[model samples]
Target: MTTSEDTLESHEVGLAAPPGEPLQTLTAAEADGLELVHQWFPAPLTVRDGSFALPPEPAWRAVVHAARRHLEAMVGAVGRLECPELGPLTQCGSAWLIRPDVAVTNRHTILSLLDDVQRGARTLRVNLSAEADGSAVLHCPVTRVLYIDPIHDLAFLRVKQRGAPQVGLVVVDSIVTANPVAVIGFPSHAEGGYAEPEYQQIFGDGWFDREGRGFKRISLGRLVSTSDTLLEHDCTTLGGSSGGVIVDLVRGSVIGLNFGESRDRRVNLGVPGWVVQQRLAQLEGSI
Candidate 1:
């Protein structure tokens, strides 16, 4: 057995194992064999100031590939609909399921979808993709609003995705300045509906979706400013990424939620995980 100690040593040296075979999609059993699902450690990997200086190309690439692959099932998209019968009119934003039956997103996204509603109501269909290859798309309709905070533009939606496992949520408290972090989201420009992770073809590092299904956008940058107001960064988020999660790949926990970007689109912002915890508490009573 290649114990966790070996894996840790590999991680430290920036060695990346391809969760079993490197043929693209790894079966659940194969993924399990490689301990991709079980391995979550706090390493020194970070992207300071919206740029990735983490080097040793092959090692970082392998590291990034593993990170995004493992989290594929938990990350998803938030589609907008004026009428369910009409299908989706537009891709409202991005979101992730914190709980099996509950999802968190920006209130602005909820409102934006509601704004175009002509009569009765608007709907948010939680779209989850299975694996990085985009084989399966699981649909969970968000029926009711469980919580809402106007100031932070955060809201919790009730989604009952039939078989989704209840995922544990993690938050980082003590802020580390200028640490390289990853912002996982589905940017509108990237067309977060496809999963073409071939950006590796051009850029030696970063993984992006191409003409494939599911828009899982993983961008590398550093935690620019850990403010009480917002965890700002150069993570380069967009209109479709309003409710995406900002995770500390190093710490293996969520640091914040992607909300908006600067007027120049250079600086992206998110609500700190601390505030995320407080808001999440509001849902506990109702859940």
Candidate 2:
């Protein structure tokens, strides 16, 4: 296995992965597989700020062109949930439109938002996409909390939409190791007082705004493992990455929903696509 202390250490100090466990390393085969994937897909890209840096690779360009419309306005930053106790916007996860009027995020994220609402805070907003200069294009409000999955860390929210395109979905029974994938979301510095240097090291300096908030970022990585309910990938993510979509680069379909990461294993965890699809069907039937 090849260890990149720099990469591992960066995530350790950030909220994505706590610092207690030892740093994780990639095996030789996994490292080579990622390099191969990047040859076709290129590296991660920030929506507004790094727009100019997009590579000329034909495959990457084609994928971006095909997926742009569905993703650009559909995936968004779940705004900070209001909490009187915290005295600030508490949760800042990511959410994406599964239907024009419905969105999905982590159950924990919805719980935090609901707790704040129960405490008398009203209005839940989702900043949808940004302009060329990094200004938000829309601030859509959540009209209702549709469903919170009891068995998984998933939740559904109904949002008022102004024609935002929903994502394409695919249910896969099994995922092969080293399958290329991309995670799209807004990754921000975790709320704690972690040093700026460490945060910069993990998230990089370009994806942030003047206020140090994160912009939309697409991180490319490979599938590490999978199970009946979970899909694990090596895609880079931070504190605010919860609820981002895990997209299959080859198929151009959403295969998972990111929720958390394991510090000991060094892989991001997500709700499998099949699980999500089943739940969505159940929700639709119930409604």
TM-score of each: 0.63, 0.70
Q: Which residue pairs of candidate 1 clash?
A: 46-180, 47-180, 47-181, 47-222, 192-215, 194-212, 195-212, 195-213, 196-210
After superposition, candidate 1 runs with Cα above 4 Å error: 1-88, 115-120, 130-133, 164-166, 190-214
**Model 1, 1-287: lDDT tens per residue?**
01100011112333221232222233667546434311321222222222233334565465565565334433443222112433433455666776667787776665635544424455667665522334565667777777767567667778776574546456666656544566665554333222234222212223323422225555555554555666666554434556777877556577887776543323567777878788787668868
Candidate 2 vs. true structure, TM-score = 0.70
lDDT of each: 0.52, 0.60
lDDT of 2 by residue, 247-282 (tens): 876665688888877555656778878777888888
Which of the numbered candidates is closest to the native, going by highest TM-score?
2
The residue-level lDDT of candidate 1 at 175 comes to 58
